[model samples]
Target: MSERTYHHGDLRRAVLTAALDVIRTDGPSALSLRDLARRAGVSHAAPAHHFKDRSGLLTAIATEGYDLLAATLADAPDLRERGVHYVRFAVGHPAHFQVMFQPDLYRPDDPELLAAKARATEELRAGVADRTPAEDAGLMGIAAWSIAHGFATLLLSHNLDRPVGDRDAEEVFRALTGVTFRTQPAGSRVGDDTMQE
Candidate 1:
């Protein structure tokens, strides 16, 4: 293979992007730094320079996942929306979601990962704070997370009974939560913003 070079910090981003694509297509177990370098068109040693080993690469992915999740949740207007956003994030970033939860795959004790996880946890907890007492917020947050996470996992694995392409995830989530969707005009579709409950 022809050797390639990256300018400045582009190498790290390229490797991470390639890693995500590999993980998304074949799961994290399929990830190889050498293969990642080839996918990124970089020197064989390039990925190792940014991520020392497999675990280090996984740790970086997990850290990035938590931070993204936190930001996604923070953008929502309320707990319900946050829960919906969580599922959306999981589905959209399946590789990240898969890696973030499987603690054995990465160095969970890494400080940056810990901090990012804390931020995500805080965002989740904050979503439930207004609805529950301080002592119960944690439990409620977990409940909300469980619902969203389970739904996303089932959806991702094609375990859900419905036709995924025909339905809006947000609509299904709202229906599961006992909230009915408001009617839309003729020719309206699942994701046209009119399907929101």
Candidate 2:
């Protein structure tokens, strides 16, 4: 592979990092390969060489986000912890979180993206494992993911009317999850807390 190819390690990471910064500051719709290239101090064509196009870039971001999500959820002690982890992941990595769920912005057919998403799904499911009966395990997993995703999205969008003064979203999420954990049958709900661990 040429130095310009993605396997170059540092360059690709630099570009991705720059892309994340762009997304965080101006939102995903504002992201452009040209802007990312400039931010990374690479040639205008560099990002294209790695990501192919804007969709490819977003796909790569989503893929990375999924892997991170899986890792974040892997060690949660319980369903409540999982929910806290999920919320924290979203708030901590808002830029990647913003693009990961937007199918219209990324290539869903990408192999890496598919694999990453599968891993994330598996991690989420593991949280509810053995807690619910096998027959309803799938439904429990879905419920857990739905609640965590909904809460995280609402928090990120500022749709949650709660005052967050001097406190991060993760703090609010942990409290909310601690109480909300009972809403499910002791087997559902995932949360992400950046402030904790």
Candidate 3:
């Protein structure tokens, strides 16, 4: 459809969807507003009216990602489940996840981006608040984020070893963090504090 035919916000959403598709297949460096406009069947100048520049477009993507992540985190029942949701969000939205973490790709100082980031951060920290001692909550939060983010990154990059096989990401994360470390290889044994009689 032509730019004028997009009705209010539809052009923006269409361009954003096109950008996501490009990032998914070719990475963010491949994004071109002109190409996005062409994909959306709009004027060459159409994307610019909404995003202004490449950085602005990326900022919009990151803002949407953080808002989505915050909502996903809010749905979890507890901190551990929140961690699962975080990994799920990252794996599910690899393009947005990549741009969200790489500040150089977007306008970090954008007000709307900052607000969306704050919401996601608040949801993440809220999960850690009552679960740990006040003195250690900060570290605990970082640790929890580290695990989820690291796992998601590895999984996305195909860096996770064969031992993990084709297991579901959420299940692997749960096994890695909970009382059992079932994600480990077959020969591995969980340490035993009560094995000896």
Candidate 4:
């Protein structure tokens, strides 16, 4: 094997990027810091500087994923749009999505991971700021998160085999949301804006 060298000043970022690439193509089971170092053209021990071990590296990936998801969700116009954005991000960044939510595999409490997760949560909250009341914000957040997360998980697992047409998954998601929430318009008199409330 050719020994490639990464002279890039940002070794940590390089290692993380390489790790993400591996996760994308091979799934989380195949990830390793040594392997990432190799892919990044750095010495086997180089990754250790940034990520003390495999778990650390995975945590970094999860943290980055949260940040990315937060950015995507923040751009949506409303809560429903945020849900669509959530699904899109999950589908587009399967590797990151896989690592982000698997608390068993990564250290969710890591400072970076926690911060990123908080940012994403805040973004989701912002999306529903106008429509959902302060008292119902938490419930609204959970409901929206559940819908988007459930749908994305289903799609990722191939549980939903419906052949979506030329329309993007976001379009299909909106349609699904419409069908699911048709009765409740933006100003509907709902109980705490929650399904169980």
Best by TM-score: 3
Q: Report the lDDT tens digits of candidate 3 across residue range 1-197.
A: 36364553688899999999999889999999999988988888889988999999999999999999999999988988998999999888988998899999999999999999999999999989968999999999998999889888987887764546788879988877784423767777774532243
lDDT by residue for model 1 (104-182), tens: 9999899999999999988988878978898888777778888889888988887774545578987788776553335
What are the models' TM-scores? 0.85, 0.82, 0.87, 0.83
What does the lDDT come to for candidate 1?
A: 0.85
Candidates by TM-score, descending order: 3, 1, 4, 2
Cα misplacement distance, residue 138 of candidate 1 (Å): 2.3
Where model 3 places Cα greater than 4 Å from the true spot, the runs are 1-9, 179-197
Q: What lDDT does model 2 reach? A: 0.83
Candidate 2 stretches greater than 4 Å from native: 1-9, 161-168, 181-197
- Per-residue lDDT of model 4, residues 5-98, tens digit only: 4455788989888877888788888988878877887888888877898898898889889999998987898878999999999999888998
Q: lDDT at 16 for candidate 3?
A: 95
TM-score of candidate 4 to 2 decimals:
0.83
lDDT of 2 by residue, 1-197 (tens): 33544554577788889989988888988998888887777778888877899998899999999999999999788877898899889988999999999989999999999999999988888878859899999999888888789888887787664455467667776786666655666555454442333
In candidate 1, where is summed lDDT lowest over 10 consecutive residues? 188-197
Of candidate 2, the 10-residue stretch with the lowest lDDT total is: 188-197
Best candidate per lDDT, number?
A: 3
Root-mean-square deviation of every model: 7.2, 6.4, 5.9, 6.2
